[model samples]
Target chain A: MADDSTSNTPRDHGDKTIEFSGLVCPVPLQDYPNIILGHGGGGKLSADLVQHVFLPAFQNDHLAVLGDSAVFQLAGVQLAGQRLAMSTDSYVVRPLFFPGGSIGDLVVNGTVNDLAMSGATPLYLTAAFILEEGFPIAQLKRIADAMGAAARRAGVAIISGDTKVVERGHGDGCYINTAGVGIVPDGIDIAPNHTRPGDVVILSGTLGDHGMAIMSVREGLEFDAEIRSDSAPLADMVAGIIQVCPDVHTLRDPTRGGLSASLNEIAAASGCGIVIDETRLPIHPTVQSACEILGFDPLLVANEGKLVCMVPAESADAVLNAIRSDKHGSGAAIIGRVVADHPGVVVAKTAIGASRVVVAPIGEQLPRIC
Target chain B: MADDSTSNTPRDHGDKTIEFSGLVCPVPLQDYPNIILGHGGGGKLSADLVQHVFLPAFQNDHLAVLGDSAVFQLAGVQLAGQRLAMSTDSYVVRPLFFPGGSIGDLVVNGTVNDLAMSGATPLYLTAAFILEEGFPIAQLKRIADAMGAAARRAGVAIISGDTKVVERGHGDGCYINTAGVGIVPDGIDIAPNHTRPGDVVILSGTLGDHGMAIMSVREGLEFDAEIRSDSAPLADMVAGIIQVCPDVHTLRDPTRGGLSASLNEIAAASGCGIVIDETRLPIHPTVQSACEILGFDPLLVANEGKLVCMVPAESADAVLNAIRSDKHGSGAAIIGRVVADHPGVVVAKTAIGASRVVVAPIGEQLPRIC
Candidate 1:
């Protein structure tokens, strides 16, 4: 069986030498003899699979960028001036319903957030559903209703969709894949590779709330205070930030592998080091207590309605203020800085003023939490 | 249990009065208390689910058009001159590999054909994969390789993709959802509602090959002649047809529920009657015999690479010639015509000179045939 250990020790694959190009798969195959749940985990195994298998198969200039969304200019002179962004994400969160959200709203907000990360104004979405044969119609109705409401809230239309039913045993209740298309406004180019030394990393709100909420339901564990998912759309907040800081280096949602994964990815792509103060990281009291009880690290837990922005130090205060003004960004804080030392590494400064390397999870810490 | 009968008797829902607007769910719910295999069969049940459940939830002008794709303009003055087409489909074919194609190629061609039906030049495709835990990596690689090859053949790029793994028994080996975006060329407007009276309906090639190819492998049935799937890309052929007949009214690929369903959909959408000569359909001899032995109606069996075109009488010859000249359209034939009488119904003239109403199948004839 694949290792289920939740160790924080950095793995060998978490190095700067591993890039998108010229990846050899046999080494990773030796580590993973068969597909595991961690392959879907947004961690080292997931990165290895994507870099070695998918990237090589579907290699292209746009995909090589590996941003949250693929932004490109539509061919032909008619659409030459307009750059469009397209993104697809499959939502397979178990338990369907959580404290604050369900798969329905999660899918819409997830794809919308993906487009927003690229500085695009999400316009349309396509929802494709894979349903189990015996799944309840009433639940399906509720899910669809939530999706429609979420789309309206995000100011985008669910213009196209598809449905397929698999045998009861062949599928979960339902899996939704929402693919979104948006228009990238002029004079805005945001990507992970844009991160540079002296960039300030600002995080939007409390970590571990979303992941902990799902775990609460799955494990039937309740905290002293209720922990609800922080799943909300972020396009408006992204627009606010871009208005104030157009030259923002990178924007990412701390989702699957949480803040640590996003930080490591940006550092590797931009050849910089990210250093965050553990004391400055935002955490909800209930979420923090729950993580402590569950022996989980808040830095490695997923957050649906959060963003990590990297901007030049000169504009850090402006970007931070812009994020703080949005409804979803009230708890935003400057938690980290990009530096020239230790490229492709993320370090945390503890309360004792000692630094420790914060490694991305090797596999899923909480399976299907997103 | 829900009805499994593949009766061709006209159901109550197959009438012109059943429009997309103001649809009530209780009526269809009575017919199907729960989703069955037929809900994904692309037959009357599938149509009812979409019209009652999905359409009502995601109501919009673009979605109401109900063409193979949703075509619209981006919301800005910058892209006012360009019209874009977007489509999504999930491929759940059994026995991933069939005689002439696999789920990989089927997914790529399926979305490409969907965009082509809107008279759009397919550009970029996003593939989302739902893989079952413990699935073979070699098979995954093979599928990815096939997808890349097929995308290259269709002249489109697989720019963005997402992968998620479900626990064993929660999924089949793999299910792929492909969402595509394409550009609708100038001066070309194609939609199911665009079919007008006196338009000539043309069949691109033989039917039932793709469906039978899967059945033969799935059931371990052998025939004298192998029935290879007629799975090929139709974008280039569609482009050629547009070059010859830019005013083509409607173009549809008779997938899932096949030619009869496509005809019924167009007839209802256009408020026109369709009459086809049964003897004129181009069916491969092996596929015809297989359908006969399997007690399947060829009219409702799926075709992957074929197209049904509706053109004005003046442009019929040019369109037919263009289709015939293409390699995939070698067996193209003029099969039917639109009539002013009996709107929302299809009639077939038997080889014995008798006329009979051709009703869409009520449910699935062969499940999981893509």
Candidate 2:
């Protein structure tokens, strides 16, 4: 039975010669009581959950092999006006409300950003809610209001949604899962594989603010801290960038595992190496200190509002300038460039001229932030 | 502040002109009483929890306006090998271990049936899971193994997925939500709108078996009669019928609210009328006795492995035979037809020439059974 289960697990890449069953999650659900926090921790637990539960539920020819994203041929079918970019996200933050932004804004912006990353003009969103009993009506009202303001700001339509309540003990105060649909523009070729050597990497503004802010509040740690979540919409910026460079290699919002995970993903997906100078890495001084004090690498922290862009080197300067001109991206920096050899390596050079391999994050730096 | 909050409250479809406003969940984290069953109940309190806690956190343009289902424009982007159909559904039926099948198999086939209703050939699926702390690992393995078998039977793959574990008492044993994407063949236009006068309606199999089975186990009411969940994939059957006749007008699984909700949704979406002869509706004698004893209307009950199809009058024989040829659909029956006038009404003519209206579900008929 166990052998049958293992043989049926979905493959990561399409090649039969190269299988990836070696990377095991620490908290295997198959051996545990139920799911643990580590399941969402993006370590072995997360991987195991995907392999055991999700992969089998949807064993499609296209999805049987996982990729950075699912790709289907868009050959000669009618994909005209209603080209949509749809995405869904579930938010389980420690606190339902947070500094600078609350759950409402996070839900709306999270999905919109996903659409934007797909190079689709994010136009519509759908929010589905599973609420617990006894949650205050006033609090629910607050989230709805925040969602409205965020939608208006993002210039998208809050179109459709669903709401259901689970019994109190069956759920927390709430768990919101959102699915979005956006139209992928015509003549655009934006994909993770589009990354190539000589492509320049851009970081929009400072990092670690959102993750740090949540960490401080949740942990009750005080820093002469004026730090707040860098939570805001980047659709406008994404649109402008895509307008200029419709074929940009990859665009990712460095959210949960911050810059480290995003960069590692690109490196692995494109089968290339990335080189970055620590001096050019953007970090708020306070955030840098917070990371140092907590013994957490700023690169491994989360950022709710920042994006990572990989564009052709010649358009690097133009793209950086354009991003910098935007209020949300004033601190934009040309952080790194893609390289051909030494694939799947993300390297950062220190001020002292030493290079350290910044491996992909094993799991969660801050739990339940997004 | 009150006016803003009121404006932001998540609006229902009862009010089409919606403006989203709501605050984050205001309940204190430390004060949370352990989770309870009511949180999953589809009631006003559940809506409140979602609005205050979940929606605010993840609010986006599309998620604010709650609807039966979100309507999307296909535009020009061709999916799979043709134009497409897409949908999503979450299953949290009680008793992870159930008669005939588990939640895993139900979820896979449920979403597949949804896509096929639009005459879309099942292609890819995305599965997301929320697992409760302390759930039995063996049971989870059982469910996952069942899901893999169902997907193999359905000929689909799960492409993308997410898994999260809520703190103990904050979630049920587990809940599974699936999103399916399928290809709709060209010149094979099927939807609610395709139903015209004289269009023949077909019922794929027995009614109320699934709902009764779940209810029996949930209520702990056993009988001399044997009952099992009629859970099975409909993709093969849909493909088979579509191949013989590309003009299959409508296809729907008689799930949640059973024959009633499916027909009502189609009637409303297509702005047509349906006349179903109650005598022609196939109800297993055991299921009939069970519903009679429980005071449940089979029409308003649920079915996991049943379909209600509408085909041209001339092709009804081919359609019925095509469906009957499948092992899962051996008991298929020609049930009714579509009418041009008296739109949005689904009426059942009884043996005594009396007609009764099938209205939309009035509220929670059976919660968490999906």
Superposed on the true interface residues, model 2 gives a C-alpha RMSD in angstroms of 6.0
lDDT of 2 by residue, B1-370 (tens): 3444324233333323211121122322221222234334333234445465545654543344232233344534444335555566767787776777889898788878877776777766666677775565557767777877887788776655656677677788787777666666766666666677888999998898888888888878777877788988887888889988888887778777678877876776677888999888888887888888888888878888888888889999998999999888998998888998678778889979999777555335666667
Query: TM-score of chain A for each candidate?
Result: 0.92, 0.86
Candidate 1's residue-wise lDDT over A269-357, tens digit each? 99888999999999999888888888999999999999999999999999989999999999999999999888878889999999988
- lDDT tens string, model 2, A159-220? 54445556556777767665555667776656666789999999999989988888877777
lDDT of 2: 0.71
Q: What shift in Å separates residue B44 of candidate 1 from its native position after superposition?
A: 1.6
Query: In angstroms, how far off is A73's CA in candidate 1?
Result: 0.5
lDDT of each: 0.87, 0.71
Task: State the displacement of the C-alpha of residue A98, model 2, in Å, after optimal TM-score superposition.
Answer: 2.7
Model 1 pairs in collision: none
Candidate 2 chain A worst ten-residue window by lDDT: A19-28
**Which of the numbered candidates is closest to the native, going by highest TM-score?**
1
For residue B15, model 1's alpha carbon misses the true position, in angstroms, by 17
